[model samples]
Target chain A: MGYPRLSIAEIREGLRRKQFSCVEITQQHLKRIEEADARLKAFLTVTPESARARAAVLDQALAAGEPLLPLTGVPIAIKDNICTQGVRTTCGSRILSNYVAPYSATAVERLEAAGAVIVGKTNCDEFGMGSSTENSAFGPSRNPFDLERVPGGSSGGSAVAVAAGEAVGAFGSDTGGSVRTPAAFCGVYGLKPTYGRVSRYGLVAYSSSLDTIGPLARSVADLAELLQVIAGHDPRDMTSHGSAPDRYTSGLDAALRNHRVGVPFSLIEEGVEAETRRAIHRALDALERAGCAVEEIALPHLANAIDTYYLIAPCEASSNLARYDGVKYGYRSEHFSNLGEMYQITRAGGFGAEVRRRIMLGTFALSSGYYDAYFLKASKVRTLLIQDFQAAFARVNTILIPTAPTPAFKIGEKTSDPLAMYLTDVFTVPANLVGIPALSVPAGYTPDNLPVAVQLLANQFHEKALLHVAWHLEQAFALKPAALAV
Target chain B: MAITLEEVRHIARLANLQFSEEELQAFIVQFSKILEHIEQLSQVDTQGVEPTYHAVAGKIDRENARSDVIHASFLQEKALMNAPESEEGQFRVPKVIR
Candidate 1:
């Protein structure tokens, strides 16, 4: 299990220098997954035969001395919620436990076309609903740093996969901090690109407006490379934009020249753990040393984001998930006497408690008289929250905040209180609400040896500048999640 | 503004989900807390602001539909691959009337 941890950059460089064949690299990663995944429970399905088959083709191409594609021979994991043709994609839900997608998602197709080796499908909270993977029907994915602690969800497994060196890079979807929270908890890099920056063609929709597939990796360069390959418009996803992706890797080493960073002073001043506060300062100090300007800014409507999101996300999710009736695909209950009873019992037996709770909350929110008071009011607040980001970004290139209020907590810490669990995503929700791009970079480890992170966000489609500043800040902090020794 | 158990049952019927008595009791307690949390949204002055139904509200052109052109899609077999019960390329479900 002591395999060398190589970033996508290092893999390309090594492959070019004839250090090892594509099969060797893929096997090394497979070996790591085999050795560490038992404890981490990161992957729901490990496709060894297909992975080896894919690697063998790359090996043949390498023997033919072919030019390197952008992501040649790089091993990557996909979140189970994103469809993979002919692979069992459970979405960590019992409802779709046996479902095999007939076609791949646009992002998965793009990654494979770029010569990436598909390693496996990783676990997630059922249908990407919960902030912690405890809602996963298959069971929660454990944090690689500490087995007793929870890995942030619903992309927890993808984060653990990259953190444990099971894969070179991974793709996870972020609706409300699904990607960034897990990355922060696991001490890695995860980027949630601007809404419509990546297509959602074959993705199983949770909250369509907020859901976007993103990459998690051990390095910013790998994160950028993954983003570059998967970004751009698709005819299948009408919301996806048509702009060409920028050369994401071209500015990884660029200096943070004239970059003004804004922090919502009062937001972080309250309720955040002291150690987490110190970690944010550590990242800001490093950025300041590298010539970044840090200033306090106001985001008056920010505190209402969590409540606004809970209402809006569940509302959208209820509509999107209406297709899971017993007549269609997925699980069907055996206890029903009639068609209507079948629909009710199928959903009751098929969905977990949290999923049903959200659906109930959403249905109530949209019911006859409640729609105006609940959904409408929440949507107006959403507008106000969006305006808050618009006002904040006017004064700075990017906003900085702690990725989470604290490090990874014990497994059962917040599961008992869904409201308590939802509050953990307090700082990460505004970006999703405004449809902006946000990146979570590991700031440092806590005294308890858990990792904490600082988040950076840019206005819509400004990933290039955001990533440039992130790369600078990454260097200023200069730490590796591979130090996890999984 | 507390949620009654009867309303909880009504919402479950609307959502087409079934819950045991025990689960409903827990839902009443937990969901009321969540409802209380979101009640603060009404206190914010959103009088003149338009509700944002979609994050990218006007950015997408939803008025016009894609052209009525035939294209490749999942075949009946592939589409029904995951159905629990199917016959003659159609998903089978319990009879609506008996």
Candidate 2:
């Protein structure tokens, strides 16, 4: 029988109807991962035995007519940066390559409680520091849309797993554009919820101030469902909010009628690809057809996102990553004769090139001579970026932009050019800088058959509005893939 | 433009990292280019704007619980398992102070 790319809702329906047992569904995903993941490199580790064991229990519960959870019997992938108790959470770095989590991340534990079976941990850029998965110690995750191109990073593996049908949906953490960029490149739906909306207790720190865990799936509804399961307050993380999570999936029913969607013309700069420009207009047209009022607006300081993000994220990264000084846990060298040698050997041997690069840059920026010029000034600009979003949101319910300037590019294409790769985040990084909710939905396809994604940015905790607009686009445009029979 | 060798060395020292000469040369170029792209933030006007350090806007409520016992079992377990040098369940390292 040919495999079909099922959504989380469809999988739930299938289990409820007894059309396919959870074990059978889990086995099918495992088989698909075994076949496709070798080429895509989507997973860092595949837990087939554990997945089958968990799915069987869910299958038995269904047979006994027990009450079912929303995501019961669904198979999902997790980014390696998230701690899974007793599972190797590498974060795609050699430093933590052998590190096993003693406790699960709050998000992962919640997903398991929802009866979602974890199929595997996906690959990412080392410490979630790069735009391409090529920075991984393992290897780059290839775009399923085009084998030679990247799937996007550092959530490339999670996005590719969903795009390639290795699983129904996946979890990815976004520091800047990690989830949305990869989802855009892979032709899937991805969301980065408002910071603190999802608990970050078990997430290995990337940039403490910016890191957020979210979902990647084939559609907006599935993304919302995943968000519902993982989002809530955790006492372990002081920054986690006490606000109750809204019924994010149910928000899909809210009408897009009379909703105001804003577009900033300044971000659609000279360097944006012509096809991307056309797709953005086409998405806006779909929104207008769905009764959204589209208006052009100016967010002048938005262009400073990449610059401000680089300074702030790394400065925090330098601080958050300081715990891995070869003394506590993770990588420690055997040849270290002195305490200084131990610190140097462990960091140099364990960290990948990109991780080291960010650490060095962060150290420089926070140094005495450069602190006022780089770190302080960047913080001030970060404030301006947030203010720009606030001003735009006052008039518009949500802001729309292309998730990426272009579709997936060839692997190893931008790995050698760091500046060029950083620009890949130009459109999406502004949301991270501002700490708002953003979702990437499939907008259209390029002439070469690659996918383009349109990102919707909503004000703080306005994920409901963003997902509603995305759902309208999904239904009106029929963005989900129609034929995945293979 | 590439970062200079001296700059890379200075950054390494500031970060408390030791690097080989070959690694320093390669990093100088890569770090310089990445920093250049990040410099674009200098163009924005940010007068009197407050930096958002945390997204959770509310003040934390601490009326719930208090703990006098701090569990050191996990730390002790890890120290026992991986400590290169240890004595009486505590990690031992060469003396840094004179």
Candidate 3:
């Protein structure tokens, strides 16, 4: 019989028991990448030489009878936006296509220090700005389940990599559902930790206030392990809360005796697919059977999440992306009469259509007469949304919602209209807007076999409880593992 | 409110991006629709509400401020490593002076 998929736990146990050499495991995953990445296009960069070099070091340490590190020899992929020293960080855009970071992100530094073998950088939407990885300048990463369908994105490549078992775990940046949507679509567990749960020191900023680096893995335990390594405060990012991270791995087996799962019923009743609605209901039933009480909760301001997110995200993006002019690094356009034209022409040539559109919308929103009307209005609406979540959390232990409105849609389906694509993130954006920890676990599959995920959100810095409930839901859906088509 | 081509060009310019005539025309339509949709923000009663995007505030300034001492940081060459054009270990830019 074929061996079970290489989960993080399996890799750790295998290495500890001397069942396989670290280099051998690394080579196996790299070979898997060579075969799977051909059609999946899940990776922008594959660091076989470096990953092998690191794995060899682990092997030597094992031969010396030394202890293993937390993620020793575990092949992990980073989203292209997160910098790794000397490795290319493109943010999946032509603007920084050839730019290589001089230093690594704090999260990357932490992951490597914990002994994760860096496999490569995965593709992402340019600047983490799109719901689908189709916004990647290089190309869209196809879903491992169906080549014709998209792996839900911005973090689609990371999700694809984990789903296809090319890497045991991966990191993805979530600005507005970048991590969760892809996780849901790819049928893996994804966690978007509370804002500042992990430092964003080296993440190519899309929207600083909302941006977070998160983990995607095939199992809840692996997701917990990955989060344990990366979650902490850094002096570099003051927004990274100074509190110590909880023992996320230990609480996975917690009984759901106190998990008050609240479902925002009316929020999903309209515009959401009937099948997805059924899946969420099914997940609620599983949680109830597992000894958790489920109730209908109201988050009224959630209806305004899309409009609020599009406005605030772009506003912050317009300011954050202004640094990408020709002067510093990255693409510089040819033929400019003067300095002003150089900046304009270079940006025109460098950014993609969606990027340009968002920057335009952002600039317009923050302009002289419109700031109070558009930007400020969106910010205040953001406060109301947070208040809704706050009020709801007071009544319920955690909130449940669909990770996305539907399963993975076809490539090129929503690309024609940008606004239509924006609606897909309607369910995922509120958690970002509220700065809470949200997780997506596979609930069920559609008739076509695409995955549908249910999301759980906990109050700020409550990743422990959030993951605990997700583990409970994950146990209920244990029979359905991530189906690989690669 | 309808966005005009002139306004679209103005914002694009403000954003330091140049758009062609066709690009600007397409943008005006898309931008107008996005603006119209986000106009729903005006319908909500946000009276006396503070405008905030982050649910939790950043740390207190007293705690956030690092010490005034200078510490190790990127050297000039390291900083300029990725620049499209570098001269004398500094990023070279188009001449700004008239």
Candidate 4:
């Protein structure tokens, strides 16, 4: 029998109705990965053995007429950054290439508890530092939409895995558009929850303050389901909020009537490509028709979001990454004379070019002489950005913008120009900086058939409102997943 | 601000990293471009703005603390499983002193 293209809800229902065995569904997805991932390079590691074992146990439970869990028999992929006990969790870098996580992330543990079969760890940028997965030590995950183009990253592999049907759903961490950008490029739904909504205990730290574990799936409902399962307070993470997660799926049925959606017109006027702008405008118009009060608003400080984000994120990254000193864990150099030389050689040899560059940039920013000028200034501007969102949200319930300035570009197009690549995140980073929830829903396809997505931003802990808007838009757009010809 | 090659070298040292002469040359150009881009932030007026260290404001309430019960921790062998080198259940490192 051929593999079925079903949403997470449908898969759950199908299993409940005894239409397919858990092992069968799991095996089909594993086979699909074996076939498609060779070309896509979406997965860094595939755990067929463990997945089969788990599927058999679930199958036995089903045979015994046990009540099914929310994600029973569902095949899911996780971004390599999140730890999975006993599984290799390489954050797309050679530094941790051989490292196996001793403990699973709270999100992963929660997903497994809900009966999700983890198929593999997806690829990502080294330390989640780059815009494209090309910075991955393993290799870039090719965009299923266009093989030559990129699946915008550093969560590119997780997005592609969902888009290409290698996994029914996947989890990716968004530290400034890592999830949303890839979701936009690969034509899927990606949600970056409000910071601290989901525990970050086992996610390999890139930028501790900005990093948030989120979900990517083919539908908004599946995304909501994944978020609801994974989001909650974990005593393991001090930063995780104490409030219980909202029933995200419960708000999916809510109407967008009378909701005010802010459109930062000036933010989109210059940097965004004409096609992407048109698509976003079209989405906004649809929301307006759906009873959202779409209005133009100005967020002048948004122009500097990328500038502020680079400074703060890298600065945090430099400090967070300092633990990899060739002593306790991960890669160490064989040819160093002293401890100091060992550290230098191990880091320089293990990290990729982009990772090293960010480390240098961060080190420079945090260095005693430059701290006040660079890091402090950026932090203050980050406060300004938070104020901008707060002021805008006072008038609007949600803010709408294109997920990226353009659709997926050729793989090598922006690789040489790091600044150009950084600009792709212009629209998505504001939510991260302000600790608000954001969703990237596939809005429309460009003339070339590349997917364009519009982002929905809600104030802190307002994911329900954000998902409500995205659900309505997803229905109106009704974007069919692009066929993976490869 | 233009970063001198010497400054790049200094930053690399601070970051515990080293690069070949060719890599250093490339990094200098790329680093300068990034610095130039970030320099735009200085134009924004941030007077009276407090630096936001955490995205969410306010100290996280430490109430409802999980009772200070010592829970099971990773075994020493499991904890050291990923270490590059281990001796006598301790992570082995290069000599520190002459």
Each prediction's TM-score against the native? Answer: 0.98, 0.94, 0.98, 0.98
Q: Candidate 2 or 3, higher lDDT? A: 3
For every prediction, compared with the true complex, DockQ reads: 0.68, 0.48, 0.76, 0.79
Error of 4 at A5 (Å): 2.0
lDDT of 3 by residue, B1-98 (tens): 69988888788879999888988778778777888888888999999999996766754245654667888999898899889899987788888888
Error of 2 at A486 (Å): 9.4
The candidates, ranked best first by lDDT, are 4, 3, 1, 2
Candidate 2 lDDT tens digits, A139-204: 898888778888899999999899888999999999999999999998899999998889998899
lDDT by residue for model 4 over A187-275, one digit each (tens)? Answer: 89999999989999999999998999999998889999999899998999989998888988886867777799999887687878898
Using lDDT as the measure, name the better of candidate 3 and candidate 4. Answer: 4
List per-candidate RMSD values in Å: 1.5, 2.5, 1.3, 1.3
**What's the CA error at residue A48 for candidate 1, in Å?**
0.2
Tell me, by lDDT, which candidate is best.
4
Chain A vs. native, model 2, TM-score: 0.97
Candidate 2 on B1-98: residue-level lDDT in tens?
35678777777766757788887877777787777776665565666776666654533456212244574435566545544456887766666776
Residue pairs of candidate 3 with colliding backbone atoms? none
| Per-residue alpha-carbon lDDT of candidate 3 for residues A1-486, written as tens digits (9 for 90 to 100) | 121368777888999899998898888889889987999999999999999999999899889998988999899999999999999999999999999999999999999999899999999889888988899999999998899999988999999988887898999999889999999999999999999889989998888889999999988899999999999888888688877899998958877777688888988888888888998888888888989888889998999999999999999999999999988899998889898899999999999999999998899999999999999999999999998998999988888888888889999999978899999999889988999999998887888888888888999999999888888777787755545676
Residue pairs in steric clash, candidate 2? none
Tens digits of per-residue lDDT, candidate 1, A81-121, equal 99999999888888898899999999999999999999999
